[model samples]
Target: MPTVDFTLRWPDGRQQRCTSPSTVIHEHFVDGQEMPVPELVARMRVAMHAASERVRARYGFACTGAAEQLEQIEAVAARYGGDAGPVTVVAVGKPAVPEVPRAS
Candidate 1:
C-alpha cells in the first residue's frame, strides 16, 4: 500500500497536513482546487473509509492513522460555520513507494 500526504488551506488561512494509508485520496482531492466545507468533509469521509478499507484488505487491519486524520479534519471543519467559504487543496504529496527486492 502507498501512503500519501495532502495539504489543505482552510478558509481561515491555516494550512493542514493530512495523511492517508492508501492512494484513494487522489480520487477525492485535486491540487489547487477549492472545495466547500461540507463537501470537503463528505468527500474526506468517503476517502478515508476507502483508504482504511484498502489497508484492512492488505494488512488484515484497518488504518488507525487515516481515521485519526479524518477526525482532525472534521474537528477543524466544524469550527467553520455553515456560511464559511471553501477550503483550498494546496498540494497532494506524491505517494511513497516501497522498495521491491529483485530476484537474485
Candidate 2:
C-alpha cells in the first residue's frame, strides 16, 4: 500500500514524524478539478488527523494537545511500490500575464 509521509511541528519547536496509508487520504479533487498548494496542505492536515485518530483507537495512546500543537504540517515523501501509487491532481498557480501582440 502507498504511504504519505509528513512532519508536524509543535508550538514548542518539537517535531513529530508521521505517516499514513494512502487509503486514508481523502479525495480532494474531482474530474478535472484543481486546487492550490494551501488547499492541498489543508487536505494533508485532515489526513494526518485521521491517522492520529486511528493510532489512538488502535494503540490507545496519543500525544497530549496534539491537535492544538500543530504548528505546521508538511508532506515529505510518498512511496508507491505496491498496488497504491501517486495521486494525480492539478495544483493551480497564479495566472500568467497575457502576451501583447507586437506589430510586425
Q: Would you estimate the TM-scores of all the predictions?
A: 0.90, 0.37
Give the candidate number with the greatest TM-score. 1
Q: State each candidate's clash count.
A: 0, 0
Tens digits of lDDT, candidate 2, 1-104: 33444443333334455444433443433322434335545676675577566557766865333343333334321212222323334222222344689999
Return the TM-score for candidate 2, rounded to 2 decimals: 0.37
Per-candidate Cα lDDT values, in order, are 0.92, 0.42
lDDT of candidate 1 over 1-104, digit per residue (tens):
88999999999999999888888999988899998899899989999999999999998999999899999999999999866998999998899888889999
The residue pairs in collision within model 2 are none
List ranges where model 2 is wrong by over 4 Å.
1-22, 26-34, 63-104
Identify the candidate with maximal lDDT: 1
Q: RMSD of candidate 1 to the true fold?
A: 2.7
